[model samples]
Target: MKRVLITVFAAFIALTAAAQSPIVQAHLEPSHGILVGQPIRMVVTVYVPNYFTGSPDFPEFEIENAIVVLPQDRPANSNTQIDGVRYAGITETYVIYPQQAGDFHLPREQVTVPFALAPPKSTIAQVPLPALAFHADVPAAARDLDYFLPTTALTMQQKWSSPMKNLRVGDTIERTVTVTATKMQSMLIPPLSLDAPSGIRVYPEEPVIHDQKTDRGDFVYGRRTQTAKYVIQKEGDYTLPSIELKWWNLSSHRLVTATLPAVHFIAAANTNYVTELPPESEPAPIAPIRHRSLWKQYRSRILITSLCCIAVALLLAMIWYWLPRARRRLQAWQERRRHSEATYFHNLQRACTQNNAAESYVWLLKWIAVADPGVSLQQALKRADNPLLTSDTNDLGESLFAQRIQDYSWNGKRFAALLRQQRKDHRMHLSKHQYLNDLNPK
Candidate 1:
């Protein structure tokens, strides 16, 4: 009996040990060095002895003065043998940007990995990954620049929509500056300042910034565009100030400036457009007449005026009483029309007849949204359970890919009729429910 008890205890210990066995490993690559405001890539690799049937839960980080940017690209999966140990792995890459200069430490991450413990015995194991740590410091050369823009290359150019020559009062001059920086982020680009002489109205537009990427999934360049519009309100010779943007030259190992020369032009008033004022004239003198005879002649006029005022007052009272009622009726009619599937169908048909694919697509989505409020177009079609409507919706979706408008026609009057029938059925169902509720009083 003692020997049997020892065997059972050993078996239990073996099971617990197997359950806690290491199945995955976590690693931070290039883990030690980064510059402040520079982005670093983090890769997490998972390894399973057998096969992984489910994804592991990856927790996000909320560290101080640091942010993690997830790539739009999917995680990479691979199978490899290291030292004759076969393993399946998945690697997830994330970019981390440190805001302040210091040592940043990330806490250990825990992931629940689901895998086949054995044949027909699948289970999940909670695994704790190793912590991530890195040091960030300011660049040595960029310390004195006061402004830093790290990039491989930088170029700036000035553009004008119209000629600045022969400027006139009330005429507008539009100037645009475009800057492109290779191997840099667009958000780091600074704003441009415009200085104009007095009597010139400067209206600066919102600056545009975009990051252009290469085909190999790497950032190629960062572009920033600044536009300002100047309106000449006073006619005079004006000098538009020069613009200078300073940036750190990563390639040259020094600071550089992109300069725009000052522009000078004269603005003359347009004499052809003029305003005329009316001439003043003396008022005619009033002649004295017989007051008694004038009063007698105007007595009937006074009575008629009183009657007309009374009639107007009655009409106003009637309108005041009926106007709100009419408004409510009109609003109810509009609401009903707006929510009706028939209305959307008709609008879609009209758009299709006009050969407007974009408008028709909008109306189709609207009708689907109305039919299934929270469901997407595809889900709504699936829920419809009608092959005809589903086929028509698919065709419509395919038509969007057509290059020319003539190639895409809805040709789905039957689908529209089906929608109308469904709407009618829904209304009937609601009315039935209402009737039952009225009879039961519950």
Candidate 2:
């Protein structure tokens, strides 16, 4: 009886195995054709004759990578199907692009599936299909032309980092500007450029940028960073017109213009440019001096004595009010002086940090300028002889600026600060007669 039961179980297993091995095939739905540069869809169907319905899960099917060539820019979608009893009907489709004109082949993959549970470990399966060759011929005219020659892009950006809205005489301000681009060039170059202001200074870097192309489009990456400084020795509110840049777009094949918003700032002057209002017109003329009587002089003396007290009170009041104001002004001036000294050293440090032969040599010019305001920058750089500063630089400066220079590289910041610092520090020079006059307070 046990043998008979085992035989029955074996027959059931055989039946299940036969049911799972379904016959499969693939075929394209459309018999017509597809163009080379256009989009086309093809349906692949597999017929499963002995589809299993025993509430059993089957092995999943998948295509190999790279083996299945997806044409340039072609999108593909796929699925599977089964038939008979509990059959799964799935249809696989492919979006194909034939990049080049050629004959191609589509071959079937070998698929393996396990079936038995406790007896025979598993069964090997072969996906039955043959390779089919297809032709992809492009127009002879397109073979010689390049597809990526022209491109176009549009980008916009804004920034606001400028200092004082109201710039006064003896005050210097800097503006931080940012420029965005569509199809831009080297970001290493200075992005922000100004029409050199007579009393203002502008500093910037050359542009350096790079980008790579992706599926959607070419991605652009670059940055232009610079400092545009302004020194206004005059006073007034001014409006700078909108900044605009024009460039040719390759994709659109046209010229494009980008305009920035307008800029507004105020300017003010120091004591030298200011004055108080005067009466409409002066009295016609003054009469000649007159002599005072003795009685009048006695009355004048009494009045003078009272007037002297009032005058003293007024003078004291004026001093009381002005002393605080004077202190604050003096403090502010000292702070500015300290900042100036700090900056002189900072700039020299920056120049030294740059190891590039050309940049270091060029910054050496700025270094000399910071050290000696009256010395021509070109002349000083031309005479640079530290080997770090090129020997040719000296000749370049002389040939360029027509000035004699002492060849040297500034290795210290104190000298740079003292370039102009000495001018103010020694202004208190006292002459023999002036010191005597100060003591007398005449």
Candidate 3:
């Protein structure tokens, strides 16, 4: 029984260690024949003994004279058995395009992987990537081409903004050319030559290049659009030169030339066109140069000077006449505003709202004096018959004048409310008294 237990424990430890070990595999899709500007798939797969706790950090590497593309797709997952032990695997793919005919090598790099050996016990492992190499050469048929574009298919189309017939001078016509290809990048597409013949002006716009892909993140095709506007400067027959592009077709394994046919158009002279008169035509008689008297020459200056003088005189007279009257009116308005009971009451309300005890007391005295001249604050409060107003005013006076602690605080919200009510009642009483006197005519 003791020997059996020891064997069981040792077997479990060996299984655990084997499950935690990670393996990395990398290889090019086609290790044999490759052509320049052709995309080659490089797939890297990572395997862990049990399961993955976190995503594996794949290293990005570049090859000389080649372009690499890593598609933004989810990593492929699978399950397999290695040496009778269950293992989880993740596969990622990268595309590489060789730009020149040469030998390309992928250097070895490290990939960080996090996986679980057993439930709730996960660990990270650094795995080294396997080295890869491939060779690319240009085919015999495409050797003479300056620019090599390898694609499965290619197509070109052209359109005009308006009809090319019956064009008149100064008319503008725009031409647009679009090139599309599969298994290629739009940036690799070259620009078109849209040169116009003499008597027409060409204004070429910047080319637009974009790539399209399916919902599964698979490359569909690449498209490039170019536009140019031709303006008719003079009336004549014009021919826009044809455009040609040479590319290597991967499907046929041969060089293909796509051509845009030449366009021809005629422009007619405009009937309403005006041009400089020829010297042979008789010249019109020159207008006689006339002489003027001194008064005529300076007539505008004389009138301006006279008007300015009259305006100055009028302005001076108006100021001299209205200055004293304006001063007198201003003085009268100031006196009325100073004696207004409403102004004094407004100042009092402002001071109370600000919670300024001393300022509130001073304004209260002034307001009471204005409401009833020669009356004291206490007398005014008593005559108003507002007990709440009287109480609040007394509190305010105590806060300002009475001896109190240094930390004493005062709130003016209640006092301001009571003051407003007292003012309203006093105004009502005064209005009633005035109405009765008017009826009695005493």
lDDT of each: 0.69, 0.44, 0.79
The number of the candidate with the highest lDDT is 3
Per-residue CA lDDT of model 2 for 1-442, tens digit only, reads: 9999999999998987666664443454333342232223344433332221111112223332211222221111112333334322223444443434455555554433222222223233455443544554434433443321111453434454556555566565655545444333332122444543354434543433444323423235333444455556556666655766554344444455656677677777676533234447866888998998877769878888899999999999999999999999999998677546355446444544442322233334334444555344333433332343334344432332232335544333333333234333433444656788988995
Strongest candidate by TM-score: 3
> After best superposition, candidate 1 residue 314: deviation in angstroms?
34
Model 3 segments more than 4 A misplaced: 1-20, 71-73, 118-120, 214-218, 271-442
lDDT of 3 by residue, 1-442 (tens): 9999999999999977755689998888778789876778888989887565455778887888888876443466666777777676778888887888988988788988766665435577898899788999988877876767788999999999988998998788999999998977787788888898788888999999988965534457889999999888789888888899988888888789999898888899987644334347688899998987989899999999999999999999999999999999999999889758888778778878988765576566557656776555555776878777777776764554343335444568778888898778778989999999999995
**Candidate 3: lDDT of 56?**
73
The regions of model 1 sitting more than 4 angstroms off are 1-33, 71-73, 80-85, 144-147, 211-221, 234-237, 249-253, 268-442
**How many collisions between residues are there in candidate 3?**
0
